[model samples]
Target: MKALVELANKAREVSGVRIYKRNVEAVLSAVLKSGDFWEIVDMSSLPVPAASGIVKVLIDEGILFIDDEENIKLTQKGFDFVRELGIETFEDHSCKACEGRGIPFYANIELYREFLQLTKDRPKAIRDYDQGSVTPETTISRVLFMDSRGDLRNKDIIVLGAEDDLTGLAIALTRKAKSVLVIDIDKRLIDFDNQIFKELGIDNARAMVWDLRNPLPEDILGNFDVFVSDPPETLPAFRAFIGRGIATLREEGGVGYFGLTLRDSSVFRWRDFQISLTSEFGVAITDIVQNFNHYITWDYHSETKAAELAPVKREPKTIWYKSAWYRIEALPGFKRWNEPISDDVFYLDEEGSTT
Candidate 1:
């Protein structure tokens, strides 16, 4: 029965439902504890937007019941299943937002820690200091974000302009993805990534110096299952990076992950960017996780400016910047943006002003 529950959880994780398996399991355990076999459990307690769908999945699998009031109840099969798994009492041990995992709402703690250990000595954030790099926590969180979306195993992932190598290292260490390729303009970043890959004996991962200002390399065009980027928040820069990412993806069902922030970009900017992605690029915005990329202050920024800012005056002592993560999926036969990168794509003048 424990194996059966594990199997069910695995299936749910790989399913297109986009909700964590632990969330569904937690809901079930809660229902069993309520002792209301005839009463429907209120769906609001679950964290996922598709909570009703999860309940329906349980019902479809003969593990739950839905009364006329739309409340949830455990079936006899469900009770037996939980009992066999040794869930004698329902205790919510998971995190409230991420369920129990430390990363997203329900991260696998072991996996998260492994990611941190692997990327602990990642290349320092110096060359691209204006677009500050994320902390180890944020990097692992990105991996968790992808895991939550069922986008990791056997997937070919490309990171446009990988600065700190956190995401690339995390994916490679998983050893599940078919391939991990990072393209960046900075030779330093690329070299650092390759050295890490070599040191870790990660054969499936590689980094190359390919500027997004140019077209994606012909050998890898339209060959990836996922593309990840933390583009410059400006309109032109964002479009350029996202355009290159889309161009590298498989024609259909390809996933793109990127980060945007409210500090620099306004609602109107978000709307335009989203519309361009969906309408012109042929991808639908599926999910947006708020404050997903928390960044640490690095040495490049002027200390005078930091002191004048607010709250924290010292460098590396505070984490005041963050970006919201965006997950978009490609529709069948989606058109990829193939425009030439504009000259202003590397603009960082706004970086200091915004920070």
Candidate 2:
């Protein structure tokens, strides 16, 4: 999972201390094996106990944590510290700056550290880019809950997808909500969520793996104040969630946000989808934010592993993200199907045409 690798790389980057090779190996091995806790044991298999003792030193220094069960847990502070190491240039662990083997390897420690802090303490899932598609709706849902604003605090928010959508939000909203109800289709994801909740001591959030297509149980009706989500973009499930989300809202104060990652083929389709929402649910476009698609070129690429590494060559990649924000408000006037042209989306003509 790209997100997991990113998280692990983040942990190492921020640690501030130059980890001995054995300790580094142990910590990474533990992080990959233990999903939530960095707990790695089997002291008998590791290099001498003196090397293991280094982990304790790291723990004492707050770089790592050993829990009651001897599981290693990285503190937010520790996690953040390691992640502070900037984007590193991979060169087979050879000192890039000094070309020496004995010294702490010089790499992009600071950048890595910041990225880790950005992702830490949030519910995040990683996947290969090709494995799943992210819709604008999904991205919007993520931004609504995770963005710097405190809009959802103390509000009852219901999420449509549990695994990727609300994992981070649940952790965040616990500080702000009276409660969060998450519904999903994956039982295993729910189990992972519970573990995270337990680790963070977040008590106001509960998750259940349930498909969004089926009719919700009676107990779930009219229970949420804000219904926000990025449902599976192509499925009827997305529409179903929208209908049910509005039904669950308390009244005129209810709010909903959707994420839809528009693909090359779906851009026109998305416009049609928007119109459908307006006609069917009286939802209006409230906010739209566009992100300049940017790529992160690191010091190392995948092919460089083991076969004599080199200083990473950086390249730029660009991707575009457009987010539309809407609210459930009564239509005030005649519905004009014409989209208001924004500079970010298109170039408009004096004749009122968009390019």
- Supply every candidate's count of residue pairs whose N, Cα or C atoms clash at under 3 angstroms: 10, 39
Off by over 4 Å in 2: 1-150, 166-174, 292-355
lDDT of 2 at 260: 47
Q: For candidate 1, lDDT tens digit of each residue in 72-152? A: 567788888777766544654445564222456225667677766656666667634244688666777778778778888
lDDT digits (tens) for residues 1-355 of candidate 2: 1233433344344432222344444444454344222113221122112223444445556666656654555677656655663312112333344222121212323423432443355333332111122332233234333323344667776776534533334334336666777776666556666665676677887778776556677677666666665543443434565666666665554666654433111344456667766776666655443221111222232332211111112211221222233344324331212222222212111111101
Judged by whole-model lDDT over C-alpha atoms, candidate 2 comes out at: 0.42
lDDT of 1 at 329: 93
- The list of candidate 1 runs beyond 4 A from truth reads 1-106, 127-129, 303-317, 349-355
Clashing pairs in 1: 40-71, 40-72, 41-71, 41-72, 94-99, 94-100, 95-99, 95-100, 98-105, 98-106
What are the RMSDs of all candidates, in order?
16.1, 20.9
On TM-score, the candidate that comes out on top is 1
| Model 1 lDDT, residue 349, Cα | 27
